[model samples]
Target chain A: MKYTGAQLVVRLLEQQGITTVAGIPGGAALPLYDALAERGSIRHVLARHEQGAGFIAQGMARASGKAAVCIASSGPGATNLVTAIADAKLDSIPLVCITGQVPLSMIGTDAFQEVDTYGISIPVTKHNYLVRNVADLLQVIPEAFRLAESGRPGPVWIDIPKDVQMASIEIDALPEPGRPDTAPCVDMDELRRAAELINAAKTPVLYLGGGIVTAGASAQAVMLAEQAGLPTTMTLMALGTMQSDHPLSLGMLGMHGARFTNYILEESDLLIVLGARFDDRAIGKAEQFCPKAAIVHVDIDAAELGKIKRPHVGIHGDVSQVLDRLLPLIQVQLRKQWLSRVSDLRSRHPLLMPGLENPRSHYGLIDAVASALDPLQADDAIITTDVGQHQMWVAQAYPFSRPRQWLTSGGLGTMGFGMPAALGAAIAEPDRTVICFSGDGSFMMNIQELATMADENANVKIILMNNQSLGMVHQQQDMFYKRRLFAVDYQRRSDFVKIAQGFGIEACDLDTAENPRAMLADALNRRGPCLIHCSIDIEAKVLPIVPPGASNTEMIGG
Target chain B: MNMRDSNINRKLNPEQSGKAVLELTVRNHPGVMSHVCGLFARRAFNVEGILCMPVGDGAQSRIWLLVREDERLPQMMSQAGKLEDVLSVARHGADHRVFEKLEEFFG
Candidate 1:
């Protein structure tokens, strides 16, 4: 059978079970888009911007735990994808990004709409391929998918020339997709040794991270924590690994993490780290983080084991597999003294819940939103957020019950990630409700995506925490920079509700309503896509911030 | 190879700067190097030299990474060996002479 390279691209995506692709078209990508139009198997989402397309793909991948595809034209279009690709890499999201290039004949003649897509994307992607020949598409396309979703999943790039996309190729049969390499087998001896350490330690803590979600080891993680009777503290990325309200859960630990959580870690004799790289944000000071703990690091990526905190026992395998073997070997013990000590610490430095009962305070907006969306909790509800003080507030206020439900740009901390990612999540799970919690500054960064949301009729409820400034930076400047604010505050407040209305989305100003909770509920309930603009005090801060380079034990505020 | 063999290999040469060679046995697959390198890059850990080639039955490859000897090296060694494709990691002194040979060849 003879097929054009463009058609083959669509066919390959279909074979990989890809039903939707988010992208925009350009001169170089016209052939591919034309082919896609001819074949109706894969639905294409037309994003307002190339970055939105890239993030939409990230959202879908993050939501579904599958390799999602994004496309772009050459030059500026491809460069626009660089941020999202980098975001995916940092978060370990599996995405395959395809970009169209100029025809082979134009090669290095500085062709119009042509950029070295491979060169630009190299640092950002897990792997990249520049398909010089049409025939190589058969191998490259499948390999791109395999590499993207395989071990330590990340974005992969494929730059296909326009001529290659237009050229027809005859193939007897497509090559079989390659099997992903299996993780290195877990050593039973190491597992037993880890178990021995856990069994012996009077104070043990389970340090969980995003790897638990990536490995689908949340169940195993919960089981290991319960069986070992260990106190658990998760990084921001591992929020929903253990239910927020779980007794063992110490909430998030690090920079903005609860003071008690860090205290427990500091006091622990053993830290059973699963699938979490000891990131700088999570570990206030490398030498001081869990200083008393003998680390037993279990991760799929071997390189993470000794990268920051050297483990006494390094178990390199799938988190689930390692946990499965290690769980039975652990002898459950009642550390009444340790438990009481942790409880005492928790009571001493409890996570400040500002608006749990009353939602009218300056910091009560996050709590109000959480309360308003409680009904959606029983359904498939997802919360995506951009970076700022609001992001931390949502992380603190929301009780995330399961993995993949709380999607935020944790590692990369990209400012404009929420709106497009929420759109992507809504696109991936149409039946679910996606609430994007964005600060005024963050919302403005990718505000163009409001049009895309309206166009798709996405079921997204955006809760805009409008503080009228870059909240986190403003707070930092206030606390450390002697209150000298520069470029952090907006001189005039933009009417977010008016902007939402202009984008064809239902908009409401919660500050104007007599009953803010009722207003929030109304917006959340009656939404194909709606934005609730909640006014917040600029002085409101995400409390209990561990000052940079300070130990987690040393926090400035609550 | 075992620790003794690696130690003997290190002992053969006397050029011992404050560098260590981490020999990794990894599955021969695309992106394995990226995974290994990315880990270092993320932590801002600098790798001085790297050498990789496929070994036995073409199913696996051996990678030699030369990095400065620091407190983090022990942890880095464990981390590199924890990669999905990595089968084993053996550390040698900077005197391993693998990069020296490559430098000689290129020079």
Candidate 2:
């Protein structure tokens, strides 16, 4: 078969089962766009910005659990897409970034619109290739896609020079590259030692992380926890690994985690950590963290076993598979005394706010909004949150009982992540309703994404917790900087309702906490991408705070 | 809170001892460092000092960790060697015989 480099890309993409592509047309990438125009089978959306294009592809990939593709031109266009590529890499979202490079001859001569995109994205991508010959284009394109979707799942870059786009390629069939096997044999001796340690410990706790969901090990992690009768504390990314409402589940741990979860981690005799590496945001102090516990670290990536703190026993294997092996060896029983102590802490420090009792606090509004979405439980409603006070509040208040139900920016506290990430989540699973919870500050960063949500007719419910200020930063400044409120507070608020209307979506205002129940009910009932502007207290802050560099004992309550 | 009581408590609890420094180089990719550090955290290894710097080229980066653990130093090196992105692992401390021999010859 004979084809141009552009046609070869489209054909290779089709072979990968990619039905949708997101990008914008520009000088360098024009030929490829022209090539895509000839193909009627594939769907392409011209996003407003190169960054948006990358994010849209990310959204599609994240939602569908498939490899999503995004294309960009050379120079500034490729640079703009770098953020989303970095985001995909950080979140382990499978994405293929195809960018048009300057023509081969003009590559290093500093041409009008030239950029070394492949070099720029090396540290951020799993693998990247700059195709020099047209013959290699067909092979490289599919190879990049395969490398991106396989293994731990991350973005890959394929940089095609402009000349390569116009060059002809002769190919009978696109040969598939051999993939190195990621599934290594588990060390059974280590697994046996892990189980023996858990069985002998009077009180053992299961610390789960994002790996649980990424590797589809939630069931196994839960089984091991249950078999050992251990209480489970999840990292933010690991929400829904175990039911939040389960008696043995302690919800999130570390900074802004539930008091009971932190208490259990600090006091447990043995901690069986699965697929979770100790992140500072998750484990505040290395020296003081799990002070009394001997740790059993089990992870597919063996490097994570003792790189943070040394584990008593390190088992290298797939989290789910290892848990399955370890379950049979654990003595089936709960440590009654340990359970009682943890239960006491759970009740005493239950996730709630006294101010919420008045039904006027920001806490009350969040609770009401969460309650309204409860009916969608049967339909599998998903929530994605941006960072700041609201994100922490939602983590504490929202009850997520299913795995992969809560998608938020846990590793990187990128504010604008909520909307695009939610849009991606919704696109991945169309049957599920994706709710984006953003602070006033976070919403403004990626407000343009509302149009993408509208264009796609996604059933995404956007909850804007409008506080008229950067609540988190403002609180820190106010408390720590002697009430010196600088530019943190936004004097004027944009009418989000009008903004949603401009995007051709329905919008409503739940001005006060008292009226959240009614507004949420209405939004939940009729929704094809609707925004709920819930007014909240500007002074609200995530409390029971552990001041920076301070011990947990130095926590201050709200 | 006085110094006298803290010293007395230290005397009563002497098990908290031993420190070693280990250096690791991993591919400069997203979450490679996070995955490595997360392992350290899970093991409850006390990190005395840690420093990370990118190599001039983007291919790899270096991480230095000062750990306070007696029996777990070998385990940490073995784990570091297992990471997918890790290029090389080396331990440098008075405790490790390899480093001690090199030091003895050089000195």
Candidate 3:
């Protein structure tokens, strides 16, 4: 059979089980788009911006735990996708990004719509390729998938020139589809040492990160915590790994964590770090964070083991496999004294939700939204958030019970992430209700996606919290910068309801509703794609905030 | 990175006396060198001297990097090894004259 490079790409993607793709088309990638049109099996969700397309694919990957694909043309199209690709790198989301390049002959001539996609993406992607020949597609396409979904998954880019995409080649059969390599064999001695450390430690904390979800090891992580009677704290990316109400679950740690959680971490004797990099945000003032704890850091990536805080037992292996072997070696202990002590601390300095009784207030608004479609009750909602105060409010108050249920950009903290990601989640899980909690500042960044959401009629209910200012920045400037607020506040407030309606989406305002709670529920319950706008107090802050360069224990408010 | 000058680059200490050389076996491709060098440049780790040439069948290349033996050198080597085109990375004493021999040519 004869196949064009574009056709082969589509076939490889089909073989990889990609039924949906999100992207925009331009000159260089016309052939790829044409091939997709001819096949007619892969449904394309047209995004308003390339960045939105990237986040949409991220949503699909983060929700499904599979490598998802995103496409863009060369030059600006490729450059726009850089942020999302970099986000995937930091968060370790699996994505295969394909872009079109100028013809090989035109590459060095500063051809129209030509930018160095391969060069620009090298620092951000796990790996990248610039396909020079049509035949190379056979190897490069499958290899891209393999690398993207392999150990310590991340984004991979494949930049095929326009000429290559139009070129044809005869082949007997397509190569086998790509699969992730088997995880590296873990050191048994390290596992033994970890087990010994856990068994011997009087006070141990199991710190889970996003890798737990990627490795499909949530159950194992919870089991490890229960078996060893270890109090568990989650990084922002690992919010849903342990159920919020679990006896030992410490919601989230560091930065905006509960005062008690940080205090407990400060006193722990040993820390069993799994699938988590000790990020600056998660481990404030590293030298002062859990200073007394002997860390047992286990990650699939060897480079991450000592990249931040060094570990007493550094085990480089997949978290799931390590837990599988280590579970049997562990001695089941109740550690009643430590449990009681933790309870006492939690009771004294809990996460203070001040405005939780009034729906008009920030925390109360999040609480009301959760009450509207309680995922804990319905078992079918995927919550996503944009960066800033609203994201933190949801992270702090939303009842996330399972991994993938919470899909926020925890690492890169990109602003315009929520709406498109919500659309992608809705597209991937049509039956599940997807809610995007966004701030006015973040919402405007990708407000154009509302048109796409309306076109698809994606089951997304965007609860936009309009503050008219970047609340986090305002708070920081107020506290840290002596109230020298500069570009944080918008001089003109946007009417988001009218904007949503203009984009053909159903929109309502809680500010005008007499009973906001009932109105929110009504809007959320009957949503194909709707925007529920609620004005927020600009002065409200996401409390228990650790100052930038201070230790977690130095948080000023709760 | 010059961790000796900054406290944030902790654990990845740069000791002036502990200079070393890194030899990498990589796939002969356009961007493989960028991938390796970008990793160092991101951390501001300087490569004082460098040499690269296609090996036996021309399908692969060997790159020798002259660098300070930062405490984070092991971690950096592991990161380099993770690159798709990098096949192997070996460390040698700074006395290795691979770059030394190229100095006259560069001059």
RMSD values, in order shown: 4.8, 6.9, 2.3
For candidate 2, write residues A1-558 as lDDT tens digits: 889998888888888887778887788898898898898768876666777788778767765667788899999989988888888876777798999988999988999778878667765677777788898775677777767766467888888888899899777877664242466677898888887889889878889987787778888888777777889998888888888878788988877876667777788888888878788778876667877888888776665666677788987777767776777788888678889988998888775564664333567766676677657463288888888998988887777877778877676577777887777677667788788888889888878888887888888888888888998889888877898999998888789999999999899887743665776877875658999887777777787667666555455673
Which 10-residue window in model 3 chain A sums to the lowest lDDT? A371-380
- Candidate 1's residue-wise lDDT over A130-197, tens digit each? 78888989988888888787778889899989999999999998777644567778899898899889
Each predicted complex: what DockQ? 0.17, 0.08, 0.44
Off by over 4 Å in 3: A374-377, B1-16
lDDT of 3 by residue, A62-94 (tens): 889899999999999999999999999999999
**The candidate that achieves the highest TM-score relative to the unseen native structure:** 3
Fnat per predicted structure, each in turn: 0.17, 0.07, 0.52
Give the poorly placed runs of model 2, Cα more than 4 Å off: A177-180, A355-361, A374-379, A512-515, B1-107
What lDDT is reached at residue A275 by model 1?
88
**Which order, best to worst by TM-score?**
3, 1, 2
Isolated chain B TM-score per model: 0.79, 0.67, 0.80
lDDT (CA) per prediction: 0.85, 0.77, 0.91
**Which residue pairs clash in candidate 3?**
B1-B45
The positional error of residue A526 in candidate 1, measured at the CA in angstroms, is 2.1
Clashing residue pair totals per candidate (backbone < 3 A): 6, 17, 1
Q: In DockQ, how does model 1 score against the reference complex?
A: 0.17
